[model samples]
Each structure stands twice: as structure tokens, then as C-alpha cells.
Target chain A: MKSKCSRENKRKLENKLFKASSLTLTLISFFTVIMIFTILLVQSKPLIMKKPLSEFLTVEWAPHLGKYGLATFMASTLFTTAIAMAISIPPCILTAIYLAEFSTPKVKEYAKSMIDLLAGIPSVVYGLWGVIFIVPIVRDRVAPPISEALGFIPVFSAQNNSGYSVIASGMVLAIMVTPIIVSVSYEVITYVPFEYREASLALGSTKWEAVKKVVLREAAPGIAAAVVLGFCRAFGETMAVLMVAGCVAKTPTSIFDPCYPLTALIANNYGEMLSIPEWVAALSVAGLILMLIVLVFNVVARIVVIRTAGE
Target chain B: MDKRKIEEKIFKYLMISSTAAIIGTLALIIGSVIVKGAAEVSVNTFINDDVALFPGEEHGILHAIIGSLYLAINSTVISFLISFPVAIYSVEYMKKKSLSPALTISIETLMGVPSIVFGMFGLFVFVLVLTRGFTLLAGTLTLALLELPLMERGIEEVVRMVPVSLKEASYALGATTFETIKNIVLKQALPGIVTVSLISFGRGIGEAAPVMLTAGFNPFPPASLLEPAASLPLAVYTYLSAPGQQGKAYASAFTLTIIVLIISLISRYVSKRFTRYVSR
Candidate 1:
């Protein structure tokens, strides 16, 4: 009887210990995030305090001239992300629709795996491919014809047609984010109730019409969330963009002109900036800005997803 | 013949073309890597350590390959230790129902934070504040942070899939909650845990930016956790930047691709086997 009582006490103690440890581990997620944010804010304090907000928002980025403006990098980041979204969203949606509605079971299985494989390819591999294949294609094949036909437009007005431009980086970013958007949108589209499709089809609608009107509308919020997620991804992509975006720290005036996104700027210059006064802190500020933008996108996307899921 | 029919046909064609484009792009990337990388593949490329130094000269990435594997395995193990417990707590112990949602959102946000930003965080916290220099340990910890969300999510999904009846049976048998979790939940989720670990390993090996900042690059093999080490992605990035090292870059990319593909295939196979066993 005494031994049985001792065993019970030991079991209870172990259970409590395990529970406490697990709870602590769970809190580490929150702890790590707050720590990262605090560290970035602290590290960037020198730059934030020294430079006026107005100067930081100006278009000039010549740090050598006492101008530590980040407007150029911010503009390029937005421009590339916008261009990437424009090129990628329609195709990604269509692909998602096909995977969810049109493809056969066998086709879906293989195609889904293929997309997963695409997603798993390392960013550096993408960078290498971008440099070797996509760069030349953009310079030799796509740019020349576009420049010839649309040279009157300022966005296509660069005369030299070097492969390293906003368009090249944008295209690469588009490809990188396609699998992410397609997979998420596919999940959302597949979750729509079959009764909606049935009701539309019973009303003399064709298959495409049913999917377009019923399924797509029901999945709209989820698709928007997916696009936002993709945007967050494209905005923060570094190595591939650094490899192909020409690393020019100027606001791009045209799609054909070279520009540097914030990520590319940090990745290329972080190591070298350690010795330069205020440069490391400036880069820390950029990092803080990137984290904030991504956090905002994530929060908005999660709210959209959760609200729709609840409904 | 009607307007509706024309619109439907156009939409169908558009979807088909989009699918074609996605698959075609995948083919183009893999095909180009294979084609260009074939010329540079040789015995020397896999064995020599001076690959980064000589650029276009005779060289290899053996040191980087080994270093990447070492880091990947170590980080994955460390992350699993932390994330597995968090998964169990969120599923089994947390009282407030709202806390789970908040936790999930926070983890997703962490996952979405850019790799370069994580590099900067590591630079400040691990390298600068803690270790006071770039080292393999700092890089491993940074990658562990990066892998935590994915590992936790993977384990949570698998644990949640465990049938309620199993736990009920354990409770009826007079097992303590911790005992039930150890013998019942974890045993059943073993395959899933393995799969998640391997996936994390693959992610760690492929990451470049975080490691580049926290783990100082060295051409020579690392002698200890505090020593600087090279990684496959960093090697590839460096080679791509040098004007004459294009061939070496392609070779390193091909090597990295093969390693990533193998890891992915093994994980897929393990999951497939697990499903088969469960169905049986």
C-alpha cells in the first residue's frame, strides 16, 4: 500500500513537470518574436535619432553625401513586388482553379508534387538560374522586341536593354511566389461547398460559369489572403533579386532600368557596411521596416482567412 | 454559338494555358541547371576544398557539402526538441481556446518574416551580443529559429490527427496524461516526426542569407561549433558573383539541387509509408 502511494505521487510529479516545460516551450515563440523586434529597434536607434524622418523619406540615397534616404530602396521594393503580382496572380489563380476543379486525380497528384518541388528549390539555385538563363532571355529576346514596339513608353525606354533590370527581377520573383499562391488558393477553392457548384449548374450554367461565379466568389477572401501572402514573399526575397536586379541604389524610372530593393540592398551591403559610420544602423532600420511590412501583411492575411473560415 | 459558350471556351483555354505555363517554367529551370551543370561536374568538383579560391580553376565543394549536412542535422534536432513540446502543449495543455489561435497566428507571422531580416536579427542577437563573432553555433541557432514554426506546425497536425478514442482508451486504462502522451501519442506520430525533421533539415541546408551573416564563411572545414564554416548556398552565391566562376556556380547549384531533391523524396516516401501502415 505504501509503495503504491509513492508510485502515484511520482507519476503526478512527472505529469506536472512535463506540462510546465511544454508551456514554457510554447511561450518561446512569442518571446523570440518580441526579442527580434526589440533588438532591431534598439540597434537602429542611432540612425533613427540622427536623421530626420523627412530626409529619410527623400528620393536621394547617396549616403556619402550625408543623405541616408531609403526612399529609393523602398520604391524599388514596391515596384518589383507590384510588377511581380501583376505578372503572377492571374496565372496562379487559373492554375489553382485547374488543380481544384478541372484536373483528374492522377494529374492533380503529380502536378501538386511538381509544384512542391518547385517550392523546395533553394533561392540560391534560383539566383544562379536567373543569372545564366533568365537574364540573357530578358536582355536578348524579350526586351529588344518590347523596346522596339513600345519604346515610346517611358517604362520600356532604356536604350541599352541590359538584362539586369526591374523587369527581370520582377519576373524571377513572380516565378518564386507562384507555387505558394497556387497551393494556398487551391486549398481555399477546394474548401468551397459542392452545393454551391451544384446550384449554379442546375440553373443552366456551364461548368466554367459555375466555377467562375459560384466557387470563385465564395473563395474571394481566401484568394485575397493568398495574394497578400505572395506579396509579402516577393517583397522580402533577397538572393535572387540581388543576383539579377543590378544592385543600383537608385529609384527606377523605367521597368528596363536597374534598381535595388531593400532586401537586395541589405544582403549586398550589410557585411561591407559594418566599418562605415551609421551604415550598420541604417541597414538595421531597413530590416525593421521589412519586418514591419511583412508583419502587417501577415496579420491582415490571417484575419481574412480566419473570418472567412468562421463564416 | 452563343456569347456564354464563347466565354466558357476562352476561360477553359486560359486555365489550360496557365497550367502549361507553370509546368513549362519548372521544366525550363531544372532543364537549364542540368544542361549547364553537366559540363562542370567532375570528380574534382566533389572532392577538392579550394573551389571557392581558384574560381575558374580546378576546384570542388566537399567542405561546403559536409558543413551544410552537419548544420542541417544539428539545427533540425535542436528545433525538434523545442517545437515538439510546443505542439503538445498547444494541443493538450493550453486552457484558453483563444490562445491557440493567437499562437498559430504568431507562428505563421514568424514564418513569413524575411530570411534576410532573420539574418539581421541573428547578427545582432547571436553573433554580436551572445557569441561576439560569427560561428557555426550561431548559424545553427538562427536556422533553428527559422525551422521552429514549420516543425511545430507539422507535429501539431500529426498529433491532432490522432484519434480521440485512443486517448480515451489510455485514460480508461488508468494511464497518466504524460504516460499516455509518451507511449500513445508520440509512438503513433513517430513517422510524422521523422518527416518533419527531414523537411527542416532540407530547409536549413538550402538557406543562404541567415547563415551568411551569422556563420562566417570559411573555405576550410570547421573544427568545432565555434569555428566558421561554409555552406552550399553561400558557396553558390559567392561563385555566381565572380565573373569567371559561372561554371562553378552552376556546378554548386546542381549539387545543392540534388541534395534538396533527395531529402524531399525521402520525406515523401516516409509519409507514403506511414499512410499505408495506418490504413492497414
Candidate 2:
């Protein structure tokens, strides 16, 4: 009895140790987000001290003249991502509807993997492809035609004939975010109970009608979450966008204008401008802004997804 | 009714064509890589590390390939250590807690943090004080952090798949939670855990932004963890910028693509096999 009790005690002690270690590790992982925010805040303190936060949000961005306005980069990031989202969302949803409703099981399986393969391709390769393929196509084929036809519209005018432009970055980002949005929307559509579709079909609606009315309606929240996730993805994408975004520090007035994004700004200059203290702080501030926006979108999306799954 | 029928038919075709368009885009990207990169690939491309300076000269990405593998393996190992434990803690200890949702939200948020921000983190934290500069160690740490949320979420998902009944049976047989977790949960989730590790490893290898910031680019191979290193993605970026070196860039991108493809394919195959075994 004594030996057995001691053995039980040993096991208990070991279990306690295991639990403690795992809990410590979990806390460490949890603290990482906090740590990242804190570090960025600390690093940006110098810039925040030199100038008010409002100063950085203005339009001018000549850092050599002590001007560090980030409005141009911010505007470029938003416009590029907006263009990407606008272009990608419709086709992505339609593709998801196809995968979820139209395809045979075997075909769905193959298509699913194909989409997965597309997602698995690295951003840098996408960047390379954008440079080699998409850039020229945009410069020569797409932009000139549109610019000539709609030169009256300020947003359609071609400011430069350079291959590197906002539209090029937007197109690359659209391609990059397609797999993500499609896959997530596909899963969400599939999760809409089949009985709901059956009920809709029983009312004499066609398959497309059932999907458009019942399935998509049921999955709207989850689909919204997926779009938000895709937005986060395209917004924070650095290298691919950097490669095609022209890296110019000017506010773009047209889709064919070369524009710089926040990610590109930080990436293109972080290495070379490390010796300048204020510039480093400005870069840190850039990262902080990126983190905040991504975090908000991510959290909102997660909550929506969790709520939808619960339902 | 006739108009509605016509509309349905049109929409069906639209959906089909849209999907086909997506597939065509994928095909175009992959086809371009293969066509442009295939002719440049040679034995020397994987064996030699020198860059060709003059016309008709040959060079290989031997160093960049090795450096990428080195960083990827080390980062995956580091992330696995933290992620696996946290995954267990989340599923085993925190699942019933009210704070579970918060933890899940945190992890998901972390997942969405940009890879470039991670690079910035590495640059500021590890490069400034820990390693004193851009080193393989700093890059590894950055990549590890970048991958941790993904790995933990993946492992947690698989752990949640372990049937409650089996765990209850273990407990009825007088097993402690730890014993049940070790002998049953881990056993059941091992394949999935391995799959997640491979996926995250593949992802780590492909990320260039974070690694570019943390791991200073070296033309030659790294001699130690403390020194700067080259990576396949960086190689693609650098070689693409050099005049007359587009072929090498394509080759490097092709090689990186192949590595990512192989890893994900293996994981998929293994997971499918594991599921089949479980069904049997």
C-alpha cells in the first residue's frame, strides 16, 4: 500500500510539472503580441517625440527635408488593396459557389488541391511573376487602352507608362488573395446545412437559385469574415507588392501612377536607412500602423467566424 | 418562368467560367515558371555558388539553397517546441475556461500579423541586442515567431479532433490526464502534428520579407549561425535585379517552388494515408 501510494504521488508530481511547463509556454506565446506592440511603441518614441502623430499622416513625404508624411503611402496601400478586393471578390465568390455546389466530388477534390497549391506558392515567386509577366501586360496591353479610352476620368489617366504602377500591384495582390478568399468561402458555403439547400430546392427553385438565395444568404457572415481575412492578407503583403508598386513616395492620382505602400516603404528603406535615428523610428511607426490595422481586421474576422460557427 | 430558367443557365455558365479562369491563372503562373526556368536548371545550378559575371559564364545557387534549408529547419524546430506545448495547453487545459476564446482570438490575430512586421520585430529586438546584428539566429527566431501561431492553431485543431470517448475510456481505466494525453491523444494526433510541422516549415522557407530584414544577405554561404545568410527567396529578388541574370532568378524561383510543392504534397499524402488507416 505504501509503495503504491508513493507511485501515485510520483505520477501526480509529474503531471503537475507537465501542466506548469505547458502553461508557462502558453503564456509566453500569448505575450508575444503584446511584446511586439510594446517594442514598436518603444522604438517609435523618438519620432513621436520629435513630431506629433498628426504630422506623419499628412501628404508630403520628403524625408531628406525632415518631412515624413505617410499619407501618400497610406493612400496607395488603401487604393491598391481596394482595387484588389474589388477585382477579386466577385470571381472568388463565384468560384466558391461552383466548387461548393456545382462540381462532382472527385472534381472538387482535385480542384481543392489545385487551389491549395496556388495558396502554397510563395509571395516572392508571385512578385517575380508580377515583374516578369503582369507588369508588362499592364503597361502595354491593359493600361494604354484604358487610359486612352477614359483619359477624361482622373483616376483612369496614365501618369507614367512605367510597368510598375498601382494597378500592377493590385493585380498581383488580387492573384495572391484569390486562393485565400475562395478556400474560406468554399468551406463556409459547404458548412451551410444541406437541409437548407434541400428545402430551397423543394420550393421549385433551381440549383443556382438555391445557392444564390439560401446557401449564400446563410453563409454571408462567414463569407464576410473570409473577405476581411483576405483584406488583411492583401493589406500586409510586403515583398510582392513592393516588387510591383514602384516604391515612389507620391500620392497616386491614377491607377497607372507609380505609388508606394507602407510595407514597401519600410522594406525598401529599412536596411539602407538604419543609421538615421528618426528614419528608423519612422519605419517602426510604419510597422506599428500596419500591425494595428491587421490586428483589428483579424480580431473582427475571428469573432465573426466564431459566432457563425457557433450558429 | 422562362426568363428565370434562362438566367439560371447563364449564371451556371458564369460560375463555371469563373472557376476556369482561376484555374487558368494558376496554370499560367506555373507554366511560365516551368517554361522560363527549365532551361536554366543544371547540375551546376544546385552544386556551385558563384554568380556569372560575363557572358557564357555559369553560376549556381548552392549557397542560397543550403542557407534557406538551414534557416527553415532551425526555425521550424524552435517553433515546434513552443507551438506544440501551447497547443496542448490550449486544448487540454484552457478549452473549458472562459478565457479560451480570448486565447483563440489572440492566436488568430497573431496569424494575420504581416511577415514584414515580424522582420521589423527581429530587426529591432534580436538584431539590436540579442545577436547584435543580422544573423541566422535572429532570422531563425523571427521566422519561428512568424510560424508559431500557424503551427499552434494547426496542432490545436488536430488535438481537438481526438475523440472525447477515447479520452474518457483512458480515464475510466485509471489513467491520469497526462497519461491519457500521452498514450492516446498524442498517438491519435501524431500524424496531424507532423503534417502541420511540414506545412509551417514549407511556409517558413518561402517567406522572404522577415528573413530579409533579420538575416542580412550574404552572397556566399553562411559559416555559422552568428553570421549572415542567403535564402532562395532573397536569391530570386537579388538575381532578378541583376542585368542578364533573369535566367538564374527563374531557376531559383523554380527551385523554391518545387521545394514548397514537394513539402505540401508529402503532408497531404501523409494525412490522407493516416485518415484511411484510421477508418480501417
lDDT of 1 by residue, A1-311 (tens): 99999999999999999999999888988677787888888887888898776767777766556667889999999998999999999999999999899889998998899999899988888888888888898998888888889889988877657899899899999999998899989988988988999999999999899998999999999999999999998988888888889878768988888889999888878777777657887888889889999999988987887676666
TM-score of chain B of 1: 0.94
Interface C-alpha root-mean-square deviation, candidates in order: 1.1, 1.0
Q: Give the fraction of true interface contacts kept by model 2.
A: 0.74
Which regions in candidate 1 have their CA more than 4 angstroms from the true location?
B51-57
Reference-based lDDT, residue B225, model 2: 93
What are the TM-scores, per candidate, against the unseen true structure?
A: 0.96, 0.96
All DockQ scores = 0.78, 0.78
Tens digit of lDDT per residue, candidate 2, span B79-193? Answer: 9999988998888877568778778878887898999999999999999889998999999999999999999999999998988888888999998878988998898998899
RMSD of each: 2.0, 2.0
Q: What is the TM-score of chain B in candidate 2?
A: 0.94
Per-residue accuracy of model 1 over B138-162 as CA lDDT, tens digit each: 9999999999988999999989888
